[model samples]
Target: MTASPTLFTRIIAREIPSDIVYEDENYIAIRDIAPKAPVHLLVIPKNVSARLDEITDAEEMGRLWLTAVKVARQHAADYRLLINSGEKGGQVVFHTHIHILAGWENGPDSDT
Candidate 1:
């Protein structure tokens, strides 16, 4: 059976273009094609792991998490990070990725 297209795979293959801000051997930081916040970027790993829970290797998971932190700092000094796991968790793309959102306030009166 054909597999679903992963977010990382689409970025790597250039099937879907992104506003790439940073890139390295291990990861790539790009602006979200559909941004929810004023400043939204997607930090994706080079490795093709489908979801966060699917990653069994501790070292690999650690590396990806670290990469997310690094990318987040670069984009926003104070950013909100999110990683949706499954459908229940709002994981639209099967591929594991960290969403860095900032440049917006989320106070009590702030609109979500």
Candidate 2:
């Protein structure tokens, strides 16, 4: 883990305010500050991992996806789950997180 806390970590620590939708001991769900879809949420793990691929444990990976689904279902009937694996994969945060995109009327739009 980095010596300094990541943005998500600060939010989880309550050092930074966020629109948290759901939270548990190991995970947290929050609305994206800059939303792409009408209902854009982020499902993040409390434990720090630079990238999703960094987590190699089968159960841990499964639980992350499961928690993301739980959070998504709580907000929308249909949703898309996304994980940007690395900087080359379009991940900016450097923290492992799942993006929950949904709440579209006529499917997702480029501009929302």
lDDT (10s digit) by residue, model 2, range 1-112:
7367899999999999999999999999999999989999999999989898889999999999999999999999989999998888999998899999998887776443
The parts of candidate 2 lying over 4 Å away from their true place are: 109-112
TM-score of structure candidate 1:
0.84
Q: For model 2, where is the 10-residue window of minimal lDDT?
A: 103-112
In Å, residue 87's CA in model 1 sits off its true spot by 0.9
TM per model? 0.84, 0.94
Largest lDDT belongs to which candidate?
2
Per-residue lDDT tens digits for candidate 1, residues 1-112, read 9677776787877898778887888788888878888888888887767778888999988888788778888766777788999899999988888898887666323675
How displaced is residue 104 in candidate 2, in Å?
A: 0.8
Compute the lDDT of residue 66 as modeled in candidate 1.
84
